[model samples]
Target: MSASLREEMELIEKHEEILGERAELLEQMESRREQLKLQRKQQVKEGEAARRRNATLLQDLQKIEDCLRGRQLPPPTILALETKYWASVEESIPAWEHFLQGKGPHPTDGPGQPSRRAKQQLKTHKETTKKTTNDQGLPPRPKPRTAR
Candidate 1:
């Protein structure tokens, strides 16, 4: 071939190589996008399932709260078990004494305290119970007196 023709052929070969690389890269990008889409769909499904489970748990908790509201006292067995559990916990953790007294960090004020969301939920529950009690024309439950 002539010199000019040979140079043009080399240029064309370089262009073809570049085009092939670009096409491969595009295919890879498309594959990655598909994978990401599938992952996002799976995450959404998992999130929905988790939300369903949480709702069911909340309903169960509400039922338990309703049952407890009607009863003035816990069963004797439960009371004894609770007393023993607390005694055991106190014995197991020496710092619990300091926490109970005014000497150290309060249990309800530190990391062990409920989260903001939990506090809000408790407030909502209290409001709901008050509303229900008022609607039913029943006397509101008295707050438990705490020991000094």
Candidate 2:
């Protein structure tokens, strides 16, 4: 009878160990399930962000295409160039006013208006400067040389 009792006690301990192992396995499975759920949620959020960004880009591209399709720009015209030059001059009114306040020459005619002879001399001077630079492979002078 004592031997039978010892065998029953050993069986009880073995069953207890098995139960403990099963409980540990269940805990590990629960942790893994929670990790998988979080990963899935993050993946869903990233997909939603990508969709919104794609939609915004598509809307912007469509607006740009619509603008392009709406108007045909006029061909290049002499009037356009003259208008642009006049606009530049109009925008420089402050600078021109400042110059007028000074004792220096008018801004419209920078320095004195070159005479025909002076203009011819300047053209020749530019030609000579260009040739010298081409021959010497050096940069042109910062200031044009004036006759003494």
Global lDDT of model 1: 0.87
lDDT of 2 by residue, 1-148 (tens): 9999999999999999999999999999999999999999999999999999999999999999999999887667966998899999899887678767874445555455854556778999999998987879766679988999
The 0-to-1 C-alpha lDDT of every candidate, in the order given, reads 0.87, 0.87
**Candidate 2: deviation at residue 50, Å?**
1.1
Question: What are the TM-scores, per candidate, against the unseen true structure?
Answer: 0.48, 0.45
lDDT of 2 at 91: 96
TM-score of 2: 0.45
- On the 0 to 100 scale, the lDDT of residue 139 in model 1 is 71
- lDDT of each residue in 14-36, candidate 1, tens digit only: 99999999999999999999999
Q: For candidate 2, what is the lDDT?
A: 0.87
Q: Residue pairs in steric clash, candidate 2?
A: none
**Model 1: how far residue 142 lies from native, Å:** 77
